[model samples]
Target: MADPTLPRADEAPGTIAAQVNKGQQFTSFDVNAFEIPNQREEVWRFTPFRRLRGLHDGTAVRTADPSIVVDGVTDGVTVETVGRDDQRLAEGGAPFDRVAAQAFSSFTDATVITVAKETELAEPVFVKVDGPGAGEVGFGHIQIRLEAFARAVIVLDQQGSGTYAENVQFVVGDHAHLTVVNVHDWADDAVHVAAHHIGVGRDAIVRHFAVSLGG
Candidate 1:
């Protein structure tokens, strides 16, 4: 699905940056409620504006964290949390389009997922991010990475009890092997927006699996 957090016609780029700066960013609203502009807009044509909103209103929901557990790990998999400015994130000139990145980055100081550089591994790493609703707003960021020849599976499971919005991002390295599974078990009223940007280095492969259980 096209991320709901993407920009709308009325929202200016500078306005968006200001909102991010003030920490008053928008959540994963139902995208269908908005209108799709003509070809003048760069990213609108390829998007599914109708299905983007789905069949629900997500503004008033609360936040809930999804549950996750690392059931298995092999020798090739090593999991570590690195600084947000680690080498991988810096390698890409700009991982995300300026506005969207600033929206989530402004509110979040630390990234939840970080894999160290040159870390060799043989197993899978499971990461779960879930939030329960409180009839308010909830925003956060998650980042992931793999060094050269690093092999592993990263699983992301997201759920919400009330209604909430969330932002996420992931990265992969050259010759690195990564498999990611994302499960969305959100309440009907919840709005979830997760952004994943992966860089496949030479001879590196990353696989993704996403399942929407509820909502």
Candidate 2:
């Protein structure tokens, strides 16, 4: 099924015609450039503002140090943690919302995973992000790239307690085949919000599956 948050191409002509600013896109993040969501905008209308724990606004602080583990490494795959200022960070899509902007501004480091061209992995790459319990709030960013003709599968597992917001980006090169699975299993009191952006190159094949078992 298509994600409800994304616009569908199969909508009726009238529905498409009813859209305002047909060619306009959301504003890119600039920290001071975006306004905090007030639950009135289209993006926030369906979100529970109170449950965000100030993630939508500037009141949230990064009080917890989340643990990240990468397992099942295979040949031709590379994983590294880098400062947010890394040039590769800009290769992904820009932030289109305040929360995304906030996450970018708040996070000091980012994780990057790269699959070399023409390389096919026999085992799935597993990335686990575990948050510390309590009322802490945290922010994070992750980027995954598959070079041309690369074939791989990745699984992201998120768990534990906290108010966390994150932005993830996937870049698929020409003729590359990439599969991603995201599993969210959080503590009952945990509050998490995330945005995922994907850029598919010509003739590339990309598949994404998401499962939310808890929150």
Candidate 3:
């Protein structure tokens, strides 16, 4: 996909910002760039504000990092724990809302998984995220990238008890195939919110399934 931050050919420089598909005007990594919703906004109207645990207003903060365990790695796969200053952090996209931006701003580290160009994995990759504890707050970010012509299946299983907000991204290169299955199975008292961004290159194919069986 073309970088949304770059000016169009017909426009002058410094004239671009990322935009959401339906309602958002612009995307930013800054949490304050977005306003706090009061249940009047379309997006937040259906959301449960009382269970947010301060993710919208920033009162709830990350107390401990989530324990991330990656399994089923193949030869062409690369997994890394990177700092916030990593050069590849936000180039693909930015947060569109306050909770997502707060997750972007508050996370102590990021999990990045990349598949090499033209490599196809026969086995699926499993990523399990264990939250801190009940009543605690956690912020997280994760990015999965598939280079040109690569094919892979990824399963994200989120577990534990807590209030968690996260921003997850997927970048698929041209002609690649990516299938993602996200399971949101948390404790009964846990509250979880997440924003996902999928950027597909020319001719890329992506299949995403989100199942909320718990929480």
Candidate 4:
């Protein structure tokens, strides 16, 4: 039998960021809406497709509980409550292809976390995503930004009951330093998909580490 799930032979090389960005505009690309003709594709080979498919058959987006803890000295970093106007929360962009945009629409209401200007935070800012239902699926989105000369550490904890998908985006300013640690601790039956977009300005340094446990 012929392999029906293979990516194109002549796919472009580069990170999704490099391929999607045209000058200053950011293009939207949903990996789930597209097809890969072969498993040799850089991003698709390591992914568990069968598990991912099971997740797609799950549920829709819903309201989630958010827990944020900002510890230690925080003169440089200020946790602000944003009401849906942040650029990281903007919608409608050219997808990696047409199919993605048509399949998965952008979510509404993303928690915007910001590190203020000239603020050098000592400890880490923890953001935890939790849900209420069991054997239930949920969806959530988050956005983070750091101003010029600011420095901070951010830990994003993604956890759910049954199965879930979370969309996250980040922006770092010039001369800023940001260290992000993503910890995914979910139930064995949970299927979680996290999408991250990070933009590092000139002279900015952003380090990311992801740790996953269970599923």
TM-scores, all candidates, are 0.56, 0.87, 0.89, 0.67
In candidate 1, what are the lDDT values of residues 21-116, reduced to their tens digit? 434443322243233333355754564434433212322322333333344555544344444445543333232332234324333333444455
Of models 3 and 4, which has the larger TM-score?
A: 3
Off by over 4 Å in 1: 1-99, 112-122, 162-167
* Candidate with the greatest TM-score versus the true structure: 3
Error of 3 at 33 (Å): 0.9
lDDT of each: 0.50, 0.82, 0.86, 0.59
Candidate 2: worst 10 consecutive residues by lDDT? 11-20
lDDT of 2 by residue, 62-85 (tens): 886667888987789899999977
* Per-residue lDDT of model 3, residues 88-167, tens digit only: 76665777788888898899989999999999999999999988788788888899999999999999999998888888
From the highest lDDT down, the ranking of the candidates is: 3, 2, 4, 1
Choose 2 or 4, whichever is better by TM-score.
2
User: Runs in model 2 with CA error above 4 Å?
Assistant: 1-20
What is the alpha-carbon lDDT of model 1 when measured against the actual structure? 0.50
